[model samples]
Target: MILDVSALLSGKVDVLEFDYIIPLLDEEGEATILPPPDVDFTSGIHICGRITDNAGYMALKASCEIGYRTACARCLTDLEGTFCYEFEKIAAKAGTIEGDEDNYVMITEGRLDLDRDVAEEVSLEFPTRFLCSEECLGLCPKCGKNRNLEPCDCANQKEIDPRLAILQKLLENQ
Candidate 1:
């Protein structure tokens, strides 16, 4: 999906609006973000926003919405949600604005690959961690029990270094 931003670059168009979805699947129909192998990305990733012809540069601002069914990152609790992430990326032609080139999505020959560009932005801007709650007690590392469901004392014991284990043994004997 290549977008012709020529008009916006020429200062003839004030804004260019866009709304579309990118299927979160590869050629084989498998989901994009995988490994859990159960995450539901059937609805695909939706991107909707506008490109404003600012006084000097074009501002590409958009929001990405992802709906998925998966387990919590820390605890293995099942959950589902529609997450929205908002981001703004500058689109400028070569040598017009000065500074770091990486800051802006470089406009090449007045054309922009909207699909690829927006997808990159979505991946970079979206949150990787999907938690059930801010203070969710995850599973205990030693006991492999869900701390939220089953409280454990495994977290209370302090791990001693091998060199310090001798001192701990001496204290225990005393």
Candidate 2:
């Protein structure tokens, strides 16, 4: 996962290949999901695009895909899906370099780790919600039952305003 850049800095153009499984982590460094899922990452990083003393900076490009199991938004059932993303990173040897929101990575001491970078990129692309089916009827609010199994008569019940009900009750009592 870690690639040494001494040769590239010494005027050599080498493409390093890396493939590995990365573990997803939450903000606190704890495993984001229990039974930690595996992520597949593959990429070819260039020590230098062209061999030259003036080879400015190293270029990194990687592709990653991850499978996620999440609860359905409507019915709360488990749903599985695959997410794929591509990343391009640049390592500057001269001064400090900053990247935009989508493409951002830092190289320190002329070394870079592809597995870590790819894992982070893939994690950022995870979907917020998952759905088993688009047409899920969801659960009934009144009876707290699943609406997909059967239609409840509560949906057809007429609603009376509280004020009207009170007036009707008073008239009947009189």
Q: Which predicted model would earn the best lDDT?
A: 1
Candidate number of the best TM-score:
1
**TM-scores for candidates 1 onward, in order:** 0.63, 0.56
lDDT of 1 by residue, 1-174 (tens): 567888898888899998878777756786554323545654667888888986966788988887877777778799888867887888887567687665577777988765655556555655555778867777665666888898988646788455556643553343
**Could you tell me which residue pairs clash in candidate 1?**
none
lDDT of each: 0.71, 0.53
* Clash count, candidate 1: 0
Misplaced by over 4 Å in model 1 are 25-40, 94-99, 135-174
lDDT of 1 at 6: 89
Please report, as a residue range, the 10-residue window in candidate 1 with the lowest summed lDDT. 33-42
Over 4 Å off in model 2, which ranges?
24-57, 98-104, 114-120, 149-153, 159-174
Root-mean-square deviation of every model: 7.1, 10.4
- Model 2's alpha-carbon lDDT is 0.53
